[model samples]
Target: MLTRIVTGLALIVLSGLYWLQADAIPQSPMSGSVGADGLPKLLALVLCGLSLIFVVQSILVRQPLAAPGIPEDDQDEDDAAFTRRGHVLAGALLAISIVYSVILPYAGYTVAMGFLLLAVGVFYHRRMSAGIATFAILGAVVFHLIFITLLGVRMPEGIWPNVLAFLHAHTA
Candidate 1:
């Protein structure tokens, strides 16, 4: 319940800030159907609604916070251990994100994102294998297809100019 309240409150505050930032975006001279702020504003509104729902659900829930198989004393210890593990995992992911941001410009989106995905997969599962690399590369390609080809968004070309150029030419 406490977790729900904290998460919901944080989401609400963040969503409000995002909405304001989106609203601050200037209109384009040659505007199409949706303006620059359209998707961000809509996403913020959705986030706000979800946050309110979380808050309300937290308030309404009345179940006892006890594990069926564990004693109360052990349960507390388990919770503490779980919390510590969660904090460590969060820190690791944050570090990965910082590293990813620093290297993204140098490596380009496809390679950087593939590395990020593979790192995350390995971190969570505590294993690295050929499948991870295959999935990571596939994920990056799908992201490129959707974001670049379908959405017409520009991605960093970096070291793989010929690869991107070939893909763009064939797709176009």
Candidate 2:
């Protein structure tokens, strides 16, 4: 709840900054359509709305400040198990992310993104492994299409330079 409120307040502040910056954008005298500031204004408004929602939700939820779910009974074994499990999970995730960052250039965006997404999905929902893999791969593909193909962002090709070459050729 603290996290929610903090993030909401931060976003609200950022949205105000965005609004100020957007208003400073020069309007085109010739163009009759929406000016350069239109998109930024819309984005600022959306951010403000979402942040307000989060702040309201956090306030209404009233999350406890203390360490929640700590048993008062003789449950040392349970607590130890929980702590060990959390430590192991967090350590493993940290290690995986470090490796992901290191090998991202060598593996290329598609493979790296797919692996990252799949790892996260599997970590969260091990029972739906196949669905998670499919979703991750699909998401990676869509991200690649939007950033690499449409936006013309240059991602490292690594082992699959031909893929980017093909995309560039087709776009040309």
Clashes of each: 0, 0
Please give, for residues 1-172, the per-residue lDDT of candidate 1 as tens digits.
6877899999999999999999999999676779999999999999999999989978886454477864433235556546777888889999999988888877888888888999998888799988888999999899888988999988786667777889999999
Alpha-carbon shift of residue 127 in model 2 (angstroms): 4.3
> What would the per-residue lDDT of candidate 2 be over residues 63-127, giving only the tens digit for each residue?
44446675432336656545777889888889779877987899988789888888878877855
Clashing pairs in 2: none
C-alpha displacement of 42 in model 1, angstroms? 29
The model with the greatest TM-score is: 1
Cα misplacement distance, residue 98 of candidate 2 (Å): 1.6
Q: After superposition, how far is residue 111 of candidate 2 from its true place, in Å?
A: 1.1
Regions of candidate 1 where Cα sits further than 4 Å from its true position = 1-82, 162-172
